[model samples]
Target: MEPVSEPSPDLAALADSVREIEHHVGEAGWDGPVRVFALVRTQEMLRTEPGLAARLDPSVLVSAREQPWHLTSVEQEELPVAPDLETLLAGLSWPSTVDGMAVSVERVVLPPAAEEAMPQDTDAALEYLLAHPERQDVRLVVGALRDGPSWCAVRSRANDTAEQVGQGPDLVPGLVAAVRSTLD
Candidate 1:
């Protein structure tokens, strides 16, 4: 792993930020989990420079609830006018750059149906999310499901594209939280 450049001079200040995030979750007691965000990049980038991901761990990290990184062939109609599942999967595989590095990260697709159940913006967020993928680096795409948990679907951009890998219970939440934090 490449070494981190250097710990910030005010490491204590950074610690405070973490505590603050924890406080928000604690005070509000947001029963739902938080998501971490990341840019889809090449495996080489991840392999050669582990420190990059570690440095971003705090600001972009998230904590998850009871769920797994699931990928099954969901029907097109089931998704909103949000576009085809294949299109999204293909777009994610398409190469993109991050920090001047050639990386093609997978896009996380949350259905419109899933978002409607949440206690947040319930309007047509899916159409906008699909139409403008570049406006935001990474987003927690929410979809509404008629008969699923309000927190139905969630995903994150993966560094590698070939295989569908998922984080362990704890790391997934941190990663989701990080990504969500960055998007917000």
Candidate 2:
């Protein structure tokens, strides 16, 4: 098989932004899932929403007139919190040929099996966890460009790991499929 190509500069930037947001939300104690959608540009968008067309680059418009252009949207909607997140995600639908997505999920931290050794006080347990590098909460963020690159970031209760960004369908396969399902 031929080697996979790298993500375009635009997708790379979007992934970086997603990672930044993930870190910020994790620090703020957000232990819920967040989904970010990417809106693409189409000729119909130009006609139905003239203001959108006006804001777009001239070259982009010209290119879009021939084929849909992947213009990432700055606006995103946070879906309502649900009991079954996967079911909720599976129910979403999006316009045709939309491009790109970012998803961040903050898992609730569970005390290790050795909890009996730690202080019973919640505050003290938390402090102990922070003081011990081996025990820390973790948050993961995944970003994807439709039919393109995908990147991921992992953050701990104490610090963010060095980013691991790359181009591949396998980077975050399940998340990518979840996001792609919306566009379909």
Candidate 3:
């Protein structure tokens, strides 16, 4: 994962917006990894989803029209514990090429066998799960666009990639979408 940079004024404002969205989605209480995707200028998205061009900000569309990578920077980092989510997000900045952002969150669900052995204490449960990997069941990856396009994928613990399970507006809505919207 790339090291996150200090957030510029614009980035800070964007983070604040995302925090509100996350609060609405209850992600503030979720224990999981958050992946940030920087949407830069690229033709791939236009090729795959031509209609997206119409919804994008005109300035972004024009700037990215000739760029090689539409999605330039993708960084996956753990949520910081201190300074709060808004503060943390506000401190990070994206390259000038970036026009939008999205966040992907993942949560691992334990299987019955693992749940049966779960400890009553939260910390103990985490330790128990770490000690016994077999108890893990599905890992859910949720992708939410700032503009409201949401998608989710699920995979067994043994699998390397997740399979798309569902996608659409408000399917797995949250702070990720709010962050993405800031780019717009």
Candidate 4:
């Protein structure tokens, strides 16, 4: 990695350079092992306060990140290619650092069919999904509005029976945990 020597002389040009770096990285793909590490020294030197970091949007970070193998959901959408569930999970708006790599989750919307599949009888399908953990990872957060039909949404990490929309079917959280507990 190139050491940070000094800020660039041309501010506008430097911004453009960063943009290109992001673009090229994204054009690559996420294939190899991943890791994410935050350098305290660098953060301290840059004076990135905790509040600022908290306020920063994970979507922006995820959007700019690069993986080594597959096209991100965002990229596929931009290409107008419909992406499957696996692709969407790989690109959701959660910041992850694996094997010193960092990527953010931008959007985690469930697909139309999946959302519709959310059973009218809340407990059964959700229970089934929980029963089979493998199925959980493949599903997205698509559900109907509180009073409306199914739509797409990101299920909460905290609640299961309560989806983000009104009182629609529950969206399970923490796939591994839900499976472990339910299966146990």
Candidate 5:
């Protein structure tokens, strides 16, 4: 394996933003709908819409102005109906105003051994996954910029504590790619 290296400022910001998003989503507990967010430069957003300051917490505004690398995530309210997240993300396109995008999705993961007994039908497969002995419920929060780095954070239901969240650039590659696609 390659030696670990220090992360760049932009990448560090991405990681912070991704983990922040994960924490925000975790507050609502589990079994929630898929959520998507638009990541924008905190300073840019406040500059473009000064009135927004009235509704934001003072600490948030302070952080935005103090930390140039701080990112703001705006939850999307109206999402187009799609069968699955991959397809939904595949068709999404973000405006230039948005620096990046993030998504929170819950999935059931099973070990390699469980794959052999998976059912063929979609419904059956989902049931099998949910009922598996070694199943894990995970919430993946991934973000990517238009022409910059990407970040991912994974939190398992069994260990939903803030300190238990795992993070990496490529932890969830497929979701990271989808987020990047929206930026393009």
Candidate 6:
């Protein structure tokens, strides 16, 4: 088992930023395409792209003024194609202009008991899982910073309530690590 990550001064900011991205994706409903967004410091972004300020949320601008670090999300307009989401993420390397990134993707999750009964064939496995009574459709919004901090938020479609959403650093380690690598 992996150890829980130590919280940094920036942890709360990153977590809130991640949650914001997650909420943005949820606004579009489910079964949407995997979305990726670059998280950049609001101050730096404004400094580099001043014209974008008018398009940004006024509240984000207000918050940026009060905090030393405020991050804003910028959705990727065109993503490079890959056979799978993990492979696509593993291949990414972000520029310094980007302080971090967040990804929203839906996945099928099954209980531990269902693992042994899972079908071996790719097609059959998917069918079996989809047909499984315990199957859950979940959306995971994961984010990682260049400074080695990460956050994750998960909402199962079965009960996607504000109180039901799960948040943690290690909730999705593999994915957090993959995104973290890009920042590194």
Instruction: Tell me the TM-score of each prediction against the true structure.
Output: 0.19, 0.52, 0.39, 0.18, 0.92, 0.93
| Arranged by TM-score, best first | 6, 5, 2, 3, 1, 4
What C-alpha lDDT values do all the predictions have? 0.28, 0.59, 0.48, 0.28, 0.88, 0.88
Candidate 3 lDDT over 83-143, as tens digits, reads 4444545555554445556554445566787688799998998788777756544433343
Q: Provide the RMSD of all predictions against the true structure, rounded to 1 decimal.
A: 18.3, 6.9, 14.0, 18.5, 2.1, 3.4
lDDT assessment of candidate 3 = 0.48
Please, what are the lDDT tens digits per residue for candidate 6 over residues 1-184?
A: 9998656646777898999998889999999999999988888888888999899779988988776568888899799999999888888889888888999999999999997899899999999999999999999999988885799999999998868899988799989888888787
Q: Return the lDDT, model 4, position 82.
A: 24
lDDT of 1 at 9: 22
Top candidate on TM-score is: 6
- Scored by lDDT, model 2 comes in at 0.59
Misplaced by over 4 Å in model 5 are: 1-6
Question: Which ten-residue region of model 6 has the weakest summed lDDT?
Answer: 4-13
lDDT string, candidate 2, 93-179, tens digits:
655555565666654344676455778898997777667645546666666565666666666655544453223334557766776
lDDT of 1 by residue, 1-184 (tens): 9876743322222222233322332333222333221222223343556665565434232211111111111112222231543343333221222211011122434456644443444354556555643432222222211111111122233322212223121333433332232222
Predict model 4's lDDT versus the native.
Answer: 0.28
Q: State which candidate, 1 or 2, has the greater lDDT.
A: 2
* Candidate 4 per-residue C-alpha lDDT over 54-166 given as tens digits, one digit per residue, 9 for 90 to 100: 55356533433321211112121231122643343344332221101111222233446666666678688666445543332211222111111221222223232222322
